[model samples]
Target: INIIMDTLAGLAFAGEAALSRYMLEKPIPKDEQLISEDMWASILINGSVAALASLFFLNYAPIRELFSRGMPIESEKAEAIFLTAFFGFFVFMHAFNTFNARTQGLNLFEHILENKLFLGIIFLIFTVQTTFIYIGGDVLRTVPLEPMEWLYMVMFALVLIPVDLVRKWVRNVWFGNPVQTRVNQ
Candidate 1:
C-alpha cells in the first residue's frame, strides 16, 4: 500500500510540475495569471491549519484507532488518525509545491531537484541515527526534542521566502531572464 501510494504521489507530483510549467510559459493577458497572491495566500493559510489539525489528531490514539476501524465518530467513534494525518500532510505539501512553483515554473523543475538533494541529506542523517539506535537495541520511540528543533523549522520556513526572492533577483538581474514563457523568440 505504501509503495502504491508513493508511486501515485510521484506521478501526481510530476503532472503538477508539468502543469505549472505550462501555466508559467503560457502567456497571460492583462488580467489572467496562473496563480494570484490571494489564491496562494489562502491555500497556504488553510493548508497550514489543516496540517496542524492533522498533527493534533494523530497524536491522539483514540482518533487514530477510530478511523482505522472505519466507525463513525458520532457512534463508534473510531478514527484512523495516522491515515488522516498522512493524507493531510501529503495534500498540504503538494499544494505548497504548486503555489511555490507558480512564479518560477521553468526553475520549478530545478528547485524540485534541489529540494530532493536536501531531503536526501536529511534522510541520510535520519537513517544513520536510526541505525545507530537499532544497533544499540534501543526502543524506537519518539524522543523529546529540543526547542531549537522547532526554532530551526521556523527558520527554514522563513528562509524559503528569501530564497525565492533571491532566485527571482538573480534570474532577472544577472541572467537577464524574464518570467518563463512559451515560444521565446
Candidate 2:
C-alpha cells in the first residue's frame, strides 16, 4: 500500500499549487497540530471506505466466477487468474482513492492538470500498473486481464469518487472549511 499508493500519490499531492488564500490565514500556533478536524473527517471516512472495499474483495465465490471467464476455478491456472484479478483490483482501487486523498475541497479535479508533474506521475502510475498486469506473469503471479474485466474493476473502484465528493460537499456545506479549525493536539 505504502509503495504503490504513497510514492505516486504523494508526488502528485506535493505538486499541488499552494493557494494564495493560505497567505491570508492566521499563522498556526506552535502547539496546534497542522492537520485540522475537517482533514481528519475526510481521512477517516475515505480511509474506511477503502478498507471496507478491500475486506469485501478478499473472498472466493461469485466474484471469481466473473473473472474466471471459462476455466474451472479449481484449476491452478484459474486460481492464478483469480489472484491476478484480485491483485489488480486492489491496485486500481488505491489508484482511484489517490484522487480523493489529494484534496479536502469539493472539486477533486480542480486544477489537477495545471500540475504537469502530478499529471505525469498519475499517468505513469496507471501505465506501469497496467503493464504489470500484462508482463508480470509468473514472477508476480499475475495474468493479463481482459479489457472488460479491467473496466469492471475500475468502474467498481470509482465508487469512491462520488462517495468522497458527497462527503466533501456535505462537510463544506454543513461543517465548513477544514482549514478554519485547529487541532490543539
Candidate 3:
C-alpha cells in the first residue's frame, strides 16, 4: 500500500511540475500570474478523494472477510491495527502529496486563478479512482462503504490542508516572495 501511495505521489508530482513549467513559460502580466483559486480547488478535490477512499477501509468486517475468505482471525485487535495503519497511511500520504505538488516553490495563497487544467486533471483522476473503488466490485476488490465512513474519511483527509496552509504562511513570511522574484528575473 505504501508503495502504491508513493507511486501515485510521484506521478502527481511529475505532472504538476510539468504543468507549473508550462504556466511559468506563458507570457502573462505579473499581477495576473498567480493561480491561488485553482490551487485551492485542486488541493480540496484531491484531499477529498483520499479521505473518501480511506472511509471504505473503516468497515473492516467486509474487507477482512474478503481477504480471509471467512476464516477466523487469530486476533481481531491485531487485524484492526493492521487495517487502520494500512489505510490511514495511504490516506495521509496522498493528501500530503496533493499539497506537495501544488506548493513546490510557489506561494499557494498568492496565486490568483491559473492552472485550471491542472485542477481538472486532479479531479478527473479522483473521479476515476472513486468509481473503480466503489463500482468496480470484484474487479477492483473493494467493498461499498457507508456514508458515515465516508464522512470520517473526508474529515481525516482534510487535516493536511490547514497544516500545509500554515507551513506556506510561514514560508511566505520568512522567504519573502520567492515566486515573484523568479517571475521578475
Give the top-scoring candidate (lDDT): 2
RMSD over all Cα atoms, model 3: 9.9
**Candidate 2 ranges with C-alpha deviation above 4 Å:** 179-185
lDDT (10s digit) by residue, model 1, range 1-185? 23323443344345333444455564568877787554464456545644565565557656454344354544422222234333433333433344344445235445445345334433443344434323423243223222443232233234234445454565566655554324363
Per-residue alpha-carbon lDDT of candidate 2 for residues 63-181, written as tens digits (9 for 90 to 100): 77777878897888778777777777777777877777766676778678778877888787788788888999878878888887787767767867888889888886897656444
Q: Least lDDT summed over 10 consecutive residues: which range in candidate 2?
A: 176-185
Q: After superposition, how far is residue 128 of candidate 2 from its true place, in Å?
A: 0.9
- Model 2: residue 173 alpha-carbon error in angstroms: 2.9
Say which prediction, candidate 1 or candidate 3, comes out ahead on lDDT.
3
RMSD in angstroms, all models?
14.8, 3.2, 9.9
User: Residue 30: error of model 2 in Å?
Assistant: 1.5
Regions more than 4 Å wrong, model 1? 1-12, 15-142, 146-148, 157-161, 178-184
Tell me, by TM-score, which candidate is best: 2
TM-score of 3: 0.47
